[model samples]
Target: MFKFQLNAITAVKALVWTAVRRMEVKDVPTPTPQPGWVLMRVRYVGVCGSDVGGFLGKNELRRPPLIMGHEFTGVVEEVGPGVSKDLIGRLFAVNPIIGCGHCRYCRSGLKNLCLMRKIIGIDYPGAYAEYVAVPADNLYPVSDPVRGALAEPLATSMRAVRLSGAGLGDSVLVIGAGPVGALAVKLLSIGGVKDVTVIDINRNRLEWAGRWGASSTLSVTGDEALKSLRETHPEGFDAVIDAVGSEDTRGLAINAVRRGGRVIFVGLHDNEVTIPGNLIVRSEIEIKGSFSYTDEDFLKAVRVLESGLLDPREGWVDIRPLERGQETFEELAGTETKYVKVMFNPGG
Candidate 1:
């Protein structure tokens, strides 16, 4: 078999932006796969909020000079010895974090929380490059149901839904109707939740939420949402999901749920935040944090994607090439369209 090599692994990098503060883009090297790894040509990659944070310098110092993109899909062009022959030419989804299974986190079946986990696009090189090297184990061959590029985010949203503890007929509330939140809404609905209300300040985002299966979309402040909570369900919701990490949203979640309702926080803000713990103390609310996804969740995410349920075209995504990723992410913060997901198409 051919050991694939790219002519160049140019990447779109994020540099500081002062004016609109929408960062500039830089191109860097492709990469070479070493032993126990597979070489891929990125096909489709999702530009997630974390990627935006890096560009906006929210996650700046944590990792600058980093190739931005984690939720991605690609084709294996070459595989080193010890990798399965079935991988080459196969469409595959990459698991950014290939955990060290012996660690306590992994041992607890929580590989996503592994302290030494190798996070692609974070700790190591990622898909924004023309060529990316991933451990053989991180590659899952794509089938008809799920496309390779979309698997990562789907897995992420799936994990959030799974950890949410929201059951069927549960009234759910998702704040910040961003891309991930919208995806969560879809997952919650599919998981048998009877109602899922999404709140966002952006009118377009609120409208976009409807496509993601939001039972209702509201453009209300946290204080107002609380007031409505009284008339709607005084006890609060069965599950309240904070998709964006904002103190206001977090507080609303605390004050808006029933005493025993579950709250799942998935969004990531650069800084630390404080919440109403006293409310939690009195209500005995169940608060859980969700990050990334599990293998089982990944498989299920693939099933959902393969089921033809989510068509990004039908939804609100604008796909660009890898070269435009930085601009696209930065532009997203200012877009007037009803956009939720912005993707990159790294070509052959």
Candidate 2:
């Protein structure tokens, strides 16, 4: 038999997405764990690039009056019926994607590709609140709260790199030096890819990419950026990953990769893009779209975080109280700032 918390709390603070480009902290009723679920006390929740797009009304899938946050870490506060009591008080990184068990994709362990999958932040209530209910099976034990929050994004990078088929000594070009792109560079470096180049209009991001593992960093944009890329590597790269997902970056990825090279699209900034189909066909460039990570990728990310191979908090990530949600979103949506990643502490 399982024991439940007798004195369950009721209200908690949360950052509520009220409308386009608007979010406010409000008092919300604390979530109660349902069967096979556990309530987690949120510690840190990272603001993903997709969250920024949602804030600007760019992502059509995100609806208003919702709690938007998927990248998070917290402690299991209470468990519902049939859940292990030992999970209580333990820190955990959540996979966030819950799929229908019978689907072929879910059966194959590719829950991210399941058509019936329901994501935490989008389909259901998310971790932007002080407490969130998650499936017990989705929990992965973690030590550090802040670093654990990074497991989701790192999983994304891992999947992109894996799909690219980049290996030892492969020359790869990553477009965009944002958090995902920079993480990709670090992963490639650890995987033995020595010649990795990162290009972004943000000098600060590019500089941090250099420190993270990029063998070369270019702070350029537009046609000039393409010109520089061609001049720098006339032979083209073995694999080019477009982490920006803009039309320009998409075009650049195809043009910068060698004939028969791989182009991995991991960014979702633009839903529709015009690409040169002839060039892709003629060059025989392999293009693949990488979405969210699988369960295995999420676990590998947690292990990587546990191994201390990367320091996500060093000079790039900013932590703020939930009260700053509006301002932070405004800042990130307006001008490009030096801050690469912004996380909210709901407890504050």
- Candidate 1 per-residue lDDT, tens place, 1-348, comes to 222244444442322232223444455444567778887877777777777666666663336556656787778887777887788888778788778889888888778888877688877766666567788887776763125567777787778787778887788888877778888888887777868888887788778788657878788786787787667777789888888776788888788788888898887754567888888988899999998887777777777777777877675777776556546765765535467777767662
* Model 1 misplacement above 4 A: 1-25, 144-146, 335-337
C-alpha local distance difference test of each model = 0.73, 0.88
Which tens-of-lDDT digit does each residue in 196-267 have in candidate 2? 999987887888888878988887777787788788788789999999888888998999999999999998
Give the range where candidate 1 is weakest over 10 consecutive residues by summed lDDT.
12-21
Q: TM-scores for all candidates?
A: 0.88, 0.95
Report how far residue 197 has shifted in candidate 1, in Å.
1.0
Residue 176 displacement in candidate 2 (angstroms): 1.1
Which residue pairs show backbone clashes in model 1? 9-29, 9-30, 11-28, 145-306
